[model samples]
Target: MMQLKWEKEGYIVSDDKTLLQMGKIEAWISGAYWAAGRSREIIEKSIQHSLCFGMYDKDGRQIGFARVITDQAVFSWIMDVIIDQEFRGKGLGKKLVECIISHPDIVHTKMGLATKDAHGLYRQFDFEMDECMRRPLL
Candidate 1:
């Protein structure tokens, strides 16, 4: 996997290994969902099956992430994206999605993601609801 590095407001993503940055990642997801009156099961599942990316402070503190789930052949689901409570209202979320959509594993496949409120942000990448994609890679 390629190292995660992208620049955002008041932060610069680094070569942080997001899977190992579990505390921050968990905080990001758990807090975001709870504020929306949802559950952390989404965060737990994200840790298990998603390619997670962390946005870091200049000092390397993780502040944000988004996850992608894919078979590396047919479909990639961009899911459960969140930035820290201290770090919203900027375009950081968009940057995170762009990074995942452009990741080496996910870019080549058709992408699918479910969002309840961020349709405008995702539409920038042409993401829309579709059938659960089904097929085999050749």
Candidate 2:
């Protein structure tokens, strides 16, 4: 996979696995309402298969994350977007979403994401609610 990176001021956003802080990611997702009790192995596996973005502070400590499962042609599902508690309210979330939507590989694909909150934030990037409901696989 090609690596994608963006930097602004003192922060960095990267899709380089080398820069990811797996421990931090696991800790955050373990407490997330959508992923509570999720195991490290599962997190690792998910990262391995998905296009992951990691946000780092000036000091290079990881503070945020998001991932997309995509075919690089038609479909993409953005998932697991989170910013560390201390980093919230600083617009990093919007930056992260912007990077995902503007990414060369993802921009033209049909993107989908589910959020219990943050609908307003995503709307700023043109994300709208889908009329179709998800069907479970047996």
Q: Backbone clashes per model, in order? A: 0, 0
Report the poorest 10 consecutive residues by lDDT, candidate 2: 129-138
lDDT of 2 at 72: 91
Give the Å error, residue 87, model 2. 0.8
Cα displacement (angstroms), candidate 1, residue 26, comes to 2.3
lDDT of 2 at 23: 94
Which regions of candidate 2 deviate over 4 angstroms?
135-138
Candidate 1: how many backbone clashes?
A: 0
- Each prediction's TM-score versus the true structure: 0.74, 0.94
lDDT of 2: 0.92
Off by over 4 Å in 1: 7-10, 14-20, 34-48, 131-138
Q: What would the TM-score be for candidate 2 when compared with the true structure?
A: 0.94
lDDT of 2 by residue, 9-50 (tens): 788999888889999999999899889999999999999999
TM-score of 1: 0.74
